[model samples]
Target: MCILFVALEAHPEYPLIICANRDEFHHRPTEAAHFWPKQNRLLAGKDLEAGGTWLGVNQNGLIAGLTNIRDPELIQSDMKSRGELVLKALINDGIDESWLARYSPFYNPFNLLYGDEKALYCFDSRAKRLNQLTAGFHSISNGALDDIWPKMSRGTQAIQAHITNNSNPCIDSLLAIMKDGTQAPDADLPQTGVSLEWERHLSSIYIQHQEYGTRSTSIILKDKRGKVQFSEVRYDGKGRNLGRNDFSF
Candidate 1:
């Protein structure tokens, strides 16, 4: 997942609302969101190359998503796949602070967001920090949590506006926000070791590079009744919408 914005306990009817986009190289093989056959309770898109996932949820009401830290300097080929982190958290119902602390050191720098129905947590490997997010709105990208990157701020603000104006929040509005392709002004772009051109390209919530870009946009909503609505819209390498899947539980 390259970008994610979550609203927690913000709406009376819904306890959690999430909008996210998963970015990757165009050629990487991936499967759209679905129930994992091996782990019958799990729902997520599979990273065929690594046998893991970027985001997922289980019937136990556990949700997990991950984003890579933009640190080319710290990346090592031998490090474990960060996608595995999301899968591990979803697979084990007993994962806790101790579990994250013990195993976090093995992977490359990453930002992991995971939680049960009651609470949400974020772990930043670069800072070696873990935070239990309070009830409100939070956003995460390739940087620190809620760091106010232009894209994160835009997404959160859009969500706030939608929730304030509409009683029944729909996935279409959230997906529209995620589909925005407007690039940030050059001055507002975050310098994350990539070239200025690349930074400008990634500034938009929806990335459209020929080689590496957003592969899918996922919106997940969990209400107080334990019902979950999940939708994923996929795209081809050139930014053309491929198809979409919707499921409710």
Candidate 2:
């Protein structure tokens, strides 16, 4: 997943809102938001190619998303399948940040987002080091440090500002550098780079997908009773429903 925007109990109306975009090669294997027939548990898109999911959620409002750290040099794939990382974190028995960090998942330098009723936190494992982002609101893309990627830096600022300045609705912001092979100028982004392009078409504010190549968008709304209502927007992105289905859980 490249670009993402998420709100974790950061607002009064909607406690958890996640909007993200996943960019990858056409050959990469992916399963959009749905209840896995074999597992019977709802999951975000899974990368059957890499064996990990970009994002997923359960019925109880347990949400988790993962983004890979891309570099010029290819990182050797470990024997442990990356797909298991999503199943490991998202299927947790509901743990806190401190507890989640200790998972020691298969991949290092991973950008992970995990949350339940109590709270949510973003984690970074750059250079094989893991750290829990301090509570409050945060965003991440792909880079050496937080808020450093060209477009992603702006996305981080937007997330904090939208969360701190407004609370009526809540802002959804998530960003990552992607090699989509299509270059376009974006308002949120001043200019586009050759290595990574700023793609607004792939961006979402409230988990709505309707354009080509866009797979699924999921949103979570938490009420004062500490309950959550989850919904998903799924599509073929090429304007075809095909066999696509969106499920919340």
Candidate 3:
């Protein structure tokens, strides 16, 4: 997941709300969100190339999502896939900080958000820090948790406003916010070592590109009653909708 907006206990009706967009190369093989055949309790989209998921939730209300840190200088071609972290987190009882501390170096720098409905935490692999998220609005992108990048700020505000105004926010409404394609002004863009042109292309909440862009948007909502709803909408290289999947348990 390239960007994720989370509202933990910030909504009156829902205690947990997550809206995220996964950006990647258009040609990578993927599967839509579903109950994994080998792990039926897990629901998430699969990255076929790496055999892991970018985001997933299990039957116990445990949730996990990942985003790569945007420093190209730190990338290692042979590093392990960061996607596997999400799988390990969902299946485990809870995040084992010591275990993660020991193994994080094998993977590229990343931000892993993992927790159950009662609590949420974000582990910054680059800094080797674990943050226990308080009850409030939070946004995580290619930077540390709640960094003020333009796109991050814009998306965080958008979701906060939507939830504050609507007592009963719908899935389509939340998904629409994630569809925003407004790019940040050139002066407002962060210098993340990418070419200016490439930075501009990725400055929006919803990226539009033929090669690398947002391939899917996922929304997860858990109400006060402990019921959960998971939804995903897929897109192609040209930014056209392919299909959608929705599940509740």
CA shift at 22, candidate 3, in angstroms?
A: 0.3
Q: What residue runs in model 2 are displaced by over 4 Å at the alpha carbon?
A: 77-79, 94-108, 128-130, 133-135, 153-217, 226-249
By lDDT rank, best first, the candidates go: 3, 1, 2
Q: For residue 162, what is the lDDT in candidate 2?
A: 56
TM-score of each predicted structure versus truth: 0.97, 0.64, 0.98
Residue 61 of model 2, lDDT score: 65
Between candidates 1 and 2, the TM-score winner: 1
What ranges in model 3 sit over 4 Å off? none
* Residue-level lDDT for 240 in candidate 1: 92
| True-structure lDDT of candidate 3 | 0.93
Q: Pick the candidate with the highest lDDT.
A: 3
Better of 1 and 2 by lDDT: 1
Residue lDDT tens for model 1, 1-249: 799888899888888888899999989999999999989899999999998899888897778999998988888899889898898889985356776778877898899999955878999988878888888888999999999789888888888899868889989988998999889999999989999999998999999988999999999999999899999999988889999999899
